[model samples]
Target: MNTIYRLLLVTLFFVSQNNQAQKRIALFNQKDLKGWYAFGEEKGKTNNADELFSVENNMIRMFGPKAGYLMSEQSFRNFELTVEYRWNTDVNVVRKNNNKNSGVMYLVPAETPDILWPKGIQFQIKEGATGDFVFLQETTLNINGTKTTPGKSVVSKRFADAEKPIGEWNQLVIISKNGVITQKLNGKTVNQGTESSVTEGRILLQYEGFPIDFRKVNIKKSK
Candidate 1:
């Protein structure tokens, strides 16, 4: 190849690789709630009250005496996110007659008002259903080639129950690109969808009347 043509080809190759490369970010610094905010369903933003959430020993502990969520202050798009979580038995959910329920909500538009459940797509982390895609607040996600309309959600048919036994950490990874998204548990891709209505927004870690522990909140995105 000619010298000039060789240089042009090398430049194009580097540019393509850079666009495909992902930039890593540590969402949770593990020392304190630096880049996050806490919102309560009843009172709106509490900035993570003492009784609602706490950070210690490189872990975030959520005490769900009520309904609220620890939300990321910044928005993201076309990224892969990973978080480790486990149900905290410190709070007896059965004694309170509540199912062990919590979730990771993403694509929450900044303009949307924060309520009991904000507008986003939720990776449902229930006892039986771990990888279900819940379109919250009329948010739509097309799964299995079918598009969801307002007030709809898609239960992952192939969503394997990869939830580790209670008290054991479960790794959850979510990838959102363009309009497509995938939900994974452990190392398995449990659910995926395309054509999300909300393309970019902030993320939320829910405290839905249940105690949960989280660690290693991180994300990688294309530049």
Candidate 2:
């Protein structure tokens, strides 16, 4: 190849790499819910408006008896997600469960039903230490390539460090890539597992009968 041709090719390659590296992805915009859709109770209330998701005091908060769901517009394959959230005190005069309850669910497939979502694996958000890691729906396999023994579930093997205090803004991080899932709470590794059922799926935030606050929920491509 000629010297000039080689130089031009090298410059083009450099430009391409730089553009990919500099890409700025927006998971959520402050002004309105640009990349999110409301499911469950809040769905019909929006009236097909552009900004369905609401923000108060710079935090996403939920209330009411009926459950709601907020999902990401774009599905993710392999990425690192960081979210911070706190639970708000319940206002129900009937005095049911006053404690906080909510969840950050990941690896959800595209064909999820409108009401039933617990079918997917749930990173629980409950009152006490139990909220840390309670595996639901999905099964966890053992190292021997067999499903885990009778009593134990996948959450036990992956996220023993799931303990977090109530009403506090806890940080949750999920790294999913190539069928491997790892989750952390408050900087502690809580769960790890491998599953081929899904490689990429939409993200969902639970609004199950309690008030919860979400500060930051963002994702970036892993290196």
Candidate 3:
């Protein structure tokens, strides 16, 4: 190949990569929880604890007992999300097992009492299992056009290095695109999977009987 031709080809490749990386698809507003909706009621009335969902000293506090979920009003299909979370109160009962702790469920269909619409997946958020991926509502997803169950687990073994001490901030990043999902905690890739189908769904924060805080919730488009 000629020198000029090779140089031109390399430049074109670089430009294409840059454009793909620069695409900003999803983002969470840091000022307030204007784009989020809270679920559940206390004492037969909807709980409007603004302090529970508001920013205090630059941190997002999520506190409430029972089964309430703070969900994003907007739905999404494929994007990369970044959130930093920490627990306000350290209680061992909440993080005892996989089922009783707080988690970030994304790509979830509108939820109902009888029929839960995870039709998506979840990024596990707990003390020891911060970056685990669990199937929630996705019946199926596609990886390179191959159909498969969405809730399948790619990393059944726990990666124990990502968790931070209670009351300290831990970083979480989730990348979902074309049925492929990846979760990172504290700069390490902990979980990844591919689904059989894709659907638009909202993000839900779980209420696992303890108080947890989220400092940052941000998302962006992926290439």
Best by TM-score: 1
Model 3, 63-181: lDDT tens per residue? Answer: 54445556777776777888888776645433323343678878777653312223456677765666665665435543335555445343233354578787778888888887677
The per-model lDDT (C-alpha) reads: 0.83, 0.63, 0.62
Model 1 lDDT tens row, 71-159? 89999988899999998887453222267888999999998887868889899988888888888778887878888768845444545
Ranking by TM-score: 1, 2, 3
Q: Higher lDDT: candidate 2 or 3?
A: 2
Clashes of each: 0, 4, 14
TM-score of 3: 0.69
Q: In model 2, what lDDT does residue 13 have?
A: 100
Q: Which pairs of residues collide in model 2? A: 158-191, 158-192, 159-190, 159-191
Instruction: Using lDDT, give the best candidate's number.
Output: 1
In candidate 2, what are the lDDT values of residues 25-139, reduced to their tens digit?
A: 6565545566677776545433332333357776776555566767776777787888888777545422224555678877676665545354345577666543343444553
Model 2 bad stretches (over 4 Å): 1-24, 41-53, 90-99, 129-159, 162-164
Candidate 3 ranges with C-alpha deviation above 4 Å: 1-28, 41-52, 90-100, 110-119, 138-160
